[model samples]
Structure formats: structure tokens, C-alpha cells
Target: MSVTAVNDVNFATQIRKEGATLVEFGASWCPPCKVLLPILDELSEQHGEKLRILKVDCDESPATASQFGVMSMPTVIVFHNGEPVEKLIGLRPKSVYENVLAKYS
Candidate 1:
């Protein structure tokens, strides 16, 4: 599975879905956010069965970004049962994400 794009309009419904949801708050101009895209894609494919991966462009979805208190590009928040449980700031190694997913999966 590939990471689905989410905007302020649907962000609430998407994250509220059953199971673990990983939301990446970023923008197109952010270099690190660009680099993190492929990693998220890989993660989506690898953990699709156990997790839902979504991306929220900060520039395009400012309201949702602000609601999550995302101050930087590539801020990743892991949500379980509609509540945020863990937050990862900046770009991180794939293993770090895998470790987080393991905790919730």
C-alpha cells in the first residue's frame, strides 16, 4: 500500500479509523520531507496490513497541521484508536519507525 494524502477536510475521519495510523505532517518544499516520502511508501507496503499511513501537506492543510502542533516538516505522529500516542520529529531512520510500529502493531 502507498501512503494516502490527507487534507484538513478529511484528516479527522482518516485518523479516527480503527487500528494504528501514522500521519506525516510535511510540505512539498521541505527537503527532508521529500527524502522521507519514499521511506513512508516502503513502510506503507511493509506494514499496510497492520497500519494505515497517511501524509498531510502542511502548506496545503494548515489547519490539521496546527491542530497536531506540528512545528517542523516531516513530523510523524503515530495514532492508535484515534488518539496520538507517539510523535517523531524530523527525519529518522527506517528502523526507528519500525520500532514504533512494533509497539502498536
Candidate 2:
């Protein structure tokens, strides 16, 4: 599976779906955010059955980003049952994300 891109319009609906959702708030101009894209794609494919990975461009979807209190370029929020359970800032190793997903999955 591939990471789905969400904007303010569909952000709520997508994250509120019936499973664990990992939403990454980022912008195209950020270097770290660019780096994390492939990582997120890999994660989506690896854990597709148990996890739903989504991306929101902070530059384009300011409403969703502000609502989540995302201050950094790459803020990763793990949502379970429509509520945020964990948040990670900046660039992190793949294993770190895997560990976080372990709790929800």
C-alpha cells in the first residue's frame, strides 16, 4: 500500500477510519520531510494490513496542521480510533516508527 495524501478537507475522515493511522504533517520545502516520504511509503507497504499511513502537506493544509498543533516540518502523529495517541517530531529511524506502531497494532 502507498501512503495517501490528505488535505484539510479529508483529513478528519481519513484519520478517523477504523484502524491505526499514521499521519505525517510535512511540507515539500523541508529536507527532512522529503527524506521521510520514502520511509513512510515503506512503512505503508510493510504494515498495510494493520496500519494506514497518510501524509498532509502543512503548506497546503494549514487547518489540519494547526488543529493538531504541529509546529515542526515533519510531525508524525499516530492516531488510533480517531484519536491521537503518539506524536514524533523531526526525522527518526525506521525502527523508531516500527516500535511506535507496535503499541497500537
Candidate 3:
């Protein structure tokens, strides 16, 4: 599955979709967010429909960021059954991501 961009309006919808959803709350200019893009892409391909990856731009959707209490860029939240199950902050290795999400997928 390809990564999909979400905004304040659609953030809830994306997170509540069937199965597990990984939402990255970030800004376009955030360095860590940029570094994570390729890793997420690779994982998306590997997981296919087992996982749904979504991105929310903090700059474009401040309310959504605030709702999630994102104090920093590149905050990744994993959601299942319409609720958050895991969260990661700042820069993280690809293995770390896989470890956090593998069970859910």
C-alpha cells in the first residue's frame, strides 16, 4: 500500500480504517520526517494491505497535531480498531519501526 496524505478533516477516517494504520505526524521541512519517508515506503510495499500508512502535515493540520499532542515533528502513531496502540517520537531506525509494528501487522 502506498502512503496517503491526510489532513485535519480526514485524519480520523484514515486512522479508523480497517486493520492497522500508521500515521506519521510531521512537517515537510522536518529532517527526521524526510529521513523516514523511504523507510515507510519500503515497509508499505512489504506489508501491502496488512498495514495502511498515512501522513499528516503538522503545518497543514495544526488541529490534528494538537489533538494528538504532538510536541515534536516526526511523531508516528500506530492505530488499530480505531484507537492508538503504539507511538514513536523523533528519529528512529527502520528496525525500530519494524519492531514496533511487526506484531500489529
lDDT of 2 by residue, 1-105 (tens): 788999999888787556799999998899999999999999988987788889999999999999999999799999988899999999999999999998988
- Compared with the true structure, all predictions reach lDDT values of 0.92, 0.91, 0.88
TM-score of each: 0.96, 0.96, 0.94
Q: Looking at model 2, how many pairs of residues clash?
A: 0
TM-score of 3: 0.94
- Candidate 1, residues 1-105, lDDT tens digits: the string is 789999999898887556899999999899999999999999988886778899999999999999989998899999998899999999999999999989988
Candidate 3 stretches greater than 4 Å from native = none
Q: What TM-score does structure 2 among the candidates reach?
A: 0.96
Write model 3 residue lDDT over 12-104, tens digit each, in one string: 877755678889999998988999999999989988878889999999999999988999989999998778889899979899889888777
Steric clash pairs (candidate 1): none
Q: How far off is residue 35 in model 2, in Å?
A: 0.8
> Which residue pairs does candidate 3 place in steric collision?
none
Model 1 vs truth, CA RMSD? 0.9
